[model samples]
Target chain A: MKLKQLFKLVLINIYHNKMRTFLTTLGVIVGTATIFLVVAIGKGGEAQVNEQYSKLNVGTIIIMPAQRGKVIDPLTKKDAELFQKSKNIAAAFPILNGSGDIKYNNYSDKSSYLGIMPQYQEASNLNLLGGRFLTEEDEKKKARNAVVGFELANVLTDGSPEDILEKTIDINRRKFEVVGVLKRMGDSGSRQSVDDSAFIPYSSAERYLLGTRANPVINAQATGLETVKGAIQDITNILNENHRLGGAEQFRIMDAGSRLASAQETARTMSLLLLSVAVVVLVVSGIGIMNVMFVTVKERTKEIGTLKAIGAKKKEILGQFLAESVVISLVGGILGVILGFANLPVLKYFQLPALPSLSGVLLGLFFSVTTGIFFGFYPAWQAAELNPIDALRYE
Target chain B: MGKESKCIIDARNIVKIYQNGAEELKVLDDVSVKVMKNDFIAILGPSGSGKSTLMNVLGCLDLPTSGQYFLDGIDILTAKEDQLAEIRNKKIGFVFQKFNLLPRLNAVQNVMLPLLYRGVEEEEAVRIAKEKLKMLGLGDRLNHRPNELSGGQQQRVAIARAIVGNPPLILADEPTGNLDSKSSMEAIKIFKELNQARNTIVLITHDTEVAEQMKRVVYIKDGRLFQN
Candidate 1:
């Protein structure tokens, strides 16, 4: 039979049994929709992580002490100086962080305090939203000056930083003038509030706050992130040499870039797992279509016999049934794409995270159509192979 | 019929056996018949006399158990199932007692079914179907479905479907069995017209009146051919 006639026949058959066709196509629709939704969730999670990662300096690396059960790094000034003089290391600064109370004339509040070097601003990509950052001269002169975080500055003073730059605040029973206030970094990849902190010169912190404490934890930045591994290795070797461990492990080094890469790899694996599950659902849906087609062939036995007696070839009969199945699945798949795309805003409304990609939609459609063809073939073949004599004799 | 004339159908020493469980029951035995082009013949038989079984074999719908059956010089008993079906489609047409019109299709579409299966163009197929229906006196009922038409009109539609493809041989298996006498006579009148128009027809019927309407009659009793 001509393809057009076959198409018309399929349409007429479906139209004759609208409810059955709709129910059969519903399985395919739900399967496809589930796949698209799962993939969107995975994509959404990855995109969220990437957006968070983009806010920081890509070339910066965090070096935390890796000693067992020890949260603080115990490096001395000599070690910090050695790292600052290493090749390809533009700048390095030791950071000694602690929580303390800041008292400013009945406006006392508790916040984190960090003792950082002058170059810490350049290394950490810290933007100062108020006054200037710590200076090398302030460190050399051991000036009791401090730069407050944006939130800390607001809590300590009633007006802007200019109105409170010369104000003195007592820390550990010592009075320090806030010469400058650092800007709020908003939130870090660690998801902690960085705006509620105070910055002071590293030397003064070592002399007064820490009381001759050894080198604290430090953060450094590289000119190029591609060389971050090499930079970390270089820093590790220098620290080992300076600590007199005779090339043995003395200080631990950690690379944030490598950590981020590992996180992304984990996300990719999760996405793949989700997609595989979706494919399984689609395969099951295909089997359902095949089963329904078989039932349809049995129901239309007389019809098949009539067409065969009228000169329709086996291939023509097969094409007619296959066309019916394919039309059902393809139509279901198209509606699935629409449903999947429509789910994006719904997810956004619930704030559940969903990234609907065009590639995912196309992939779902391709699978649904292929499922129809693959599953429809066997039933169609069975219908075509039916003997006209037996079929006509069948009630 | 003269030996020189082409016999549209010739069956000799035909036999058909049905296997039910272990016992083999013979349905037809040593049946022989000949029909020439344009001859209107009737096979008269009672129930279970194998008239319908013989019709199935002659229509290329079933293979005889052991026999020689030829249709238009082709060995129908030896032809493949698909080939037999093609011969039936292109050279023979059938009108069943129940009319057997697809309930979903209207009169015109019902008549166009065989041509559509033969891959005829839609416009030409529709034109021929309309013309045949008109000729069958169903012109005004072209858009009516089977349920909407009267018993006689439905049979006329079936007859139109049978002859629209212009097949040389037409088979009617109790074509008037379901109709009233008046309607049956009307259907017979159409069959007479088709026969006079040079269309060979083989009609199976038990009604003496129906058989008398044909030019010749062959009788079958207990699966064996007999003289009427």
Candidate 2:
């Protein structure tokens, strides 16, 4: 039989039984939609991770005291100074993390602050929107100056960056000049959002805000991407010798690449889990298709017999039934792609990241069609193999 | 018929048995029959007399347990299933008691089925089907589905479908069983007309009245055959 005519026959049958066709393809629709959405969300997560990491210097590494037994000398300013002189390390600074209530005129809000040296600006890839960042003179003189984050500057003063810069803000009852307003970089990969924090000289933070009792972490930048390993090695040796640690490791070293890797791994794991769920749904939907095809063949037994008597070969019979199933799934797949696209706005409403991709849509369609073929074959074969005598005799 | 008249159906010592596990029930026993070209014959039997089984075997729908059967000079016993399908497509037209029109298809589409299966172009099939339906007094009902037609109209449509391909033989099993008396007479008239037009026909039924109208009658009783 001509394929087009055969398809028309299948279509006529499917069209007449609208409810059955809709119900049979429902599972496939949901399955493929899920597949598409899962892929989009996975891509969104990867893009998010990449964007976060891209905001920071690639050679930046964080060294913190690996909390085990206390009383081992914590990383100090002297240790940071030693790292700055090391051949592999290009720049190093001790970071003192603290939160304080800031008062700018009548507006007051609690914000976290990072205390670091002037070199920390380049190491952290901080971009200024107005004025200049902290200088060597400011660190050496222990001047009370702060470079506010984009959001912090908005909160402390007028929304304008130029207005926020050079404005004085009260931090823990001490006045500090806002020398610069940093550009917005959103949430960092390794820490809290940089947009909500302020940067100040480490000398002033140690002497005035956080006292000598607070432990400080050292942030360092390698001379080049290739020197990161050597930089980490130099940091460990310096901290071990300076702190007088014998055999046990005291500090934990983390590089930007490793952090990016772990984030990517998390994204990949989530994608795999969702893909499995989509597969399960597809399998269950496939079984549904198989079940419906069986019922259809049974119900059309006399019709099958009639067609056989009229000269339809077994393969023609098989093709008609199989094509019916494939068309059902193909329709479902197309609807699923539309549904997936439709869900993008809902995800956005919930503030979830999702990036629609062509590959995801293709994969979803491929899965649905494969499911149809895999589950549709046996039932079609059964219809083709039916005895014409019994079939025609069937009530 | 003359000695030169070719046999359309020639069966010798045909036997059909139905097996249920270890128990076996014989449906046909040593039944032999011959049908010459353009012959009109009826095999008459009551229920359980295996008349339907004989129709099935003769239609090449089921294989006999032991038999040498030839359909239009082609060996039915040795022909493969696909070969039987092809032969049935090109040589046999079947009209059933139920009419058996596919409900989803319109009259024309249903009538075009055999030709479609024979790989006829759809346009040609449709055109031929329309002409056949017109000749069968179904011209106004070309697009009507089976349910939309009366039993007689549905039967006419089935006859149109059966003869649309102009096959050599028409096998009808209780073709008038589902029709009213008036429709049954009309169906019988059409079959006689077809037979007179040089198309071979074998009608299976238990109704003596229906069988009496045929040119030849064969009686089947409890899997055995007798002719008068």
RMSD to true structure for each model, in Å: 5.5, 3.0
Write the residue-wise lDDT of candidate 2 on A1-395 in tens digits.
99999999989989988898888889999999999999999999988888977776778888887883363577788878899898998888899888879878888779888888888887678899888999999999999999988888787675765587778988888899989889987777545667888888999888889886557888888888899999988888887678765421777888887888888899899889999999999999999999999999999999999999989899999999999999889888998899999999998899677999999999999999999999999999999999988888889
Give each model a TM-score.
0.79, 0.91
Itemize residue pairs with steric clashes in candidate 1: A75-A215, A76-A215
Q: What is the DockQ of each candidate?
A: 0.49, 0.82
Scored against the true structure, residue B138 in model 1 reaches a CA lDDT of: 87
Off by over 4 Å in 2: A65-73, A103-106, A155-158, A224-230, A244-251, A349-352, B1-6, B20-26
lDDT tens per residue, model 1, A277-384: 777877888888899999999988887877776677788889999998998898888888888888788878987568888877887788788989999999999999
lDDT of 2 by residue, B1-228 (tens): 574388999999999999989999899999999999989999999999999899989999989999899998899999899999999899899999999999989999999999989999999999999999999999999999999999999999999999999988899999999999999999999999999889899999999999999999999999999977
